[model samples]
Target: LLWETMILPIIRGNKLDGYVLGTKLCPPEFLPRTTPGSTVKIPNPEYEEWLSNDQLLLGWLYSTMSSDIASQLMQKATSKELWDGAKELSGAQTRSRIVYYKAELQKTKKGGMKMEEYLTTMKAIADNLAMAGNPIPLPDLIVQILSGLDAEYTPIVTLLTDKISVSWIELQTNLLTYESRLEQLHTYQTDGIQANHASAHFATSSTTNRPFTSTNGRGQNRYYNGRGARGRSRGRGGRSSVSSSSSFCSRRIVSASCHLFYKSTTLFHNLGMCPQIMKCRYNWSYIKF
Candidate 1:
C-alpha cells in the first residue's frame, strides 16, 4: 500500500521533480554558469531550477525512507541515484528472499490453525515477495495455497482448481465458508457422541440402584442390594460386605473386580458374580464390561 501510494507514482514520472520514468531530467551543458574567472560563479537559472527540483525529490525520498536506508544513500547526489541505490540493495537480497517466501508458501499447512490465521500467513508471505519486486502471479499463488492446505480442505481446493480464473477475494470467501462448514460438522459429531454417552450412563445408573430379592426352597430369603460402578452393594443375610467397583457380598472376600454377594439361610457365598449385571473393568486406555 505504501508503495502504491507514494513510491510507485513518483517513480513513473514528474517533470517538476526533475524525474521522467525514474531518471533525473538533466539540464543541458549550456545551462551551467560561465561566469568570469572570479571563482564565485553562480549557476544559471535553468541549472539552478533543476538542482532545486532534484533536492526536493531527494528530500522527499529520505523523509519516506527508514533511517538505515537513508543512511546508506547519503552519498547519492540525486533522487534517481538514491532510488537506484535502494533498488540495488533490494535486488541483492531479492533472490534469497523470494526463495524463502516461495518455500514457506509451498510448505505451510493449515493444521490446527484457524482459517484466518492460515490465510494471513499465506497473504503476508506473498506481500513480502511483492515488496521484493518478485510478486508471485495470482494463479501460481493459488496453486501454492491449495498445496499447503491440509487434506480436509481438498474438496474446496479441487473446486477452485477446476476454475479457469479465481480472484483472490473469491478464494478467501470460499475457504472461510468451507472452514465454517467443517466446524459445523465437528460440532454435530461431538453432540451425537455426548448424547450416546448420556444414554448409556442413565441406563447403567438406573438398573444398578435397586434391591433384588430371591427366595430359597426352605422359606429362606436372600436380598441383594445393587450399586453402580463406583458404589457398594450389601447382603442382608450377613453382616459382612466387601467393596469394589460393584459390590462383594461375602463373609471373607477381597478382589478388585465387580462382584455380588448373597447369603442363604445355610451359609454365605464367597465372591459371586452379579446376576444379569454388567461387571466393569477400568484402565488408563479404555473401559470394559
Candidate 2:
C-alpha cells in the first residue's frame, strides 16, 4: 500500500510511496541479474548499482526513524534487514509494551504544557495504544487525562468526577474552556492592581503639589461674598482658638464696650466678655460690671 491521498494528504504530497516496500530489491550479494529464459541462476551484471541503491535506501529509512530505533538498527547489513527488523520490533505489542504504555500514560503530568498541547500529547498516546490493538475505553481515557492534570485543574476535575459519565471530547473542551477562564481572571486581577497603583500615585502627586496654609490676608472674610454673607464664614479673620459656645458668651466677665445676650432678652452692656465672633471696639480690662 502507498501513502493514500484521501487519508493523509501531507504524506502523499511529500512524494513518498510504497514502491520500495512492495518491490523487494535483493541485496548485492544475493543477486546480480535475471535470465530471460533459463530457470537456472546466472550472475551477469549490475551488482554495483544494486549495492548503491540498497545503501541509499537504508540511509533514507534510518534518517526517518527516531534516535532510539535508528541506533538499534544502525548495524543491520542491508536495507531489507533493517526494514524487517524494524517491522518485527514495532509489530509486537506484547504485554510488557502495553504495560509500559499504560504507565507512561499514567505518569505523563500536565505540569507546564498548555491546555492544547497537554491534550494533544495524551491523545497521541491513546492513539498509539489503539493502533497497537489495545484501545482504552472512553471513561478510562477521561480519568487518565484528569489524573495527569495538576492541582490548578482540580475544580474541573472534581466537577467531572462527580458525574457518572463523561466523554473525552466533552472533557477536553471543558478543560480548554477552564484554561481560558483562568487566563481571563488573571488578566482582570492584573488590571485592577495596575488601576489601584495609578490612583495611589495620582493622590500622592496631588498632595505634593498642594499648599498647607491660606493665601488670603487675615482681614479677609470668606463670607463677604458678592452674593451675600449667608453661611458660616471660612476666612482667616474667623479663625479662633476657642471652641464654639452654646450662647453669645459661655462665661461671664467684665468688658468695657462689648455686649452680651443674657436670658435671650436682656442686654448686659458691661457684664460679659466679647465672644470671638464679636468685633470688639474696646479693651475688656477697663470694663465696669
Candidate 3:
C-alpha cells in the first residue's frame, strides 16, 4: 500500500537517481553466483536466500527508475509531436502546458508526487529543444519504443476526442438557448410597458374634459354668472358695508367700474368674441389706487 501511494509517483515523475541507488544495492545476478561448496555449503543456502530477497527488492527499484525516465521522455516527445502537428499551435500549447503544470503543482499541497514537477521540467526542456531545432533526446526515443507496446493508446485517444466534440456541441447549444430566452424576455417586457402606457393614455382621455370647444366657436371656455353688472354692484356694496370705517369709499366708484369691465372683457374673450371695450388700457387707473 505504501509503495503504491508514496513511491509510485516518484518513479513515474522520472526521478531515477533515488531508484537507481536503491536497485544497485541489490542485483538478481548475485543469487545465481552463489555455489554449493564443500565447506561453505552450510552457509551457502542462507546467503542464496538473502540474495533472492534482495533481488526482488532490486527488481522493483529498477523498474521504477526505468518508468520514471520513460515518463519524462514521453512528455517531451508528446510536446514535440503536438508542435509538429501545427506550427501556429506551438505557443498556445506551451501556454496550456504551463497552466496545467501550475495547477498540478498547487495540487501537491497534501504530500503529492514529484512526477508532476518532473513532467513540467521535461516540457520546458522539450520547448527549448523545439526552439533550438535539436535532435530528439535518447530517453524520448526509448519512450516512443515503449508507447507502441500499449495497445489501448488508439482507443483512449478516440474516446477523449469524442468527449471533447460532445462538450463543444453542448456548450454552443446552451449559449444559443440562453440568448434566445433573453431576447424573448426583453421583447415581452418592452411590449408590456408600451401596452401599459397606451392603456393609461386611453383611460386619461376618457376621464378628462376638453378645455377648448370648436363646436361653440370658442378656443377656450370660461364660467361666469350671467348677471355680471348687478353682481359687481352688490359685491361692492357688501364690501363697503363691511369696511365702512376705512377710506376705501374714496375710490369706491372707480373700483366698481374696473371690476365690472374686467369681468365683461374676460367673459367675451373666452366666448371667442373680440370685445370692443378697451378695459385693459384702463388697468393703469386701478394701479394708482
Q: Clash totals for all models, in order?
A: 1, 0, 2
Candidate 3 local Cα displacement, residue 98, angstroms: 4.8
lDDT of 1 by residue, 72-112 (tens): 77988877787778777766667788899878887897788
- The predictions' CA RMSDs to the true structure, in order, are 12.7, 20.5, 26.6
lDDT of 3 by residue, 27-121 (tens): 23223344566332133555465455444444554354345433433332222232223233334555665566444433322123232343344
lDDT of each: 0.62, 0.59, 0.37
Off by over 4 Å in 1: 1-5, 11-43, 212-220, 226-289
lDDT of 3: 0.37
Model 1, residue pairs in steric clash: 249-261
Task: Please rank every candidate by TM-score, starting with the best.
Answer: 1, 2, 3
- Residue 265 lDDT (model 2): 15
Per-residue C-alpha lDDT of model 2 across residues 134-175, encoded as one tens digit per residue: 889988988888988888789999999999998777888899
Which is the better candidate, 2 or 3, if ranked by TM-score?
A: 2
Ranking by lDDT: 1, 2, 3
Better of 1 and 2 by TM-score: 1
Clashes of 3: 2
Ranking 1 against 3 by lDDT, winner: 1
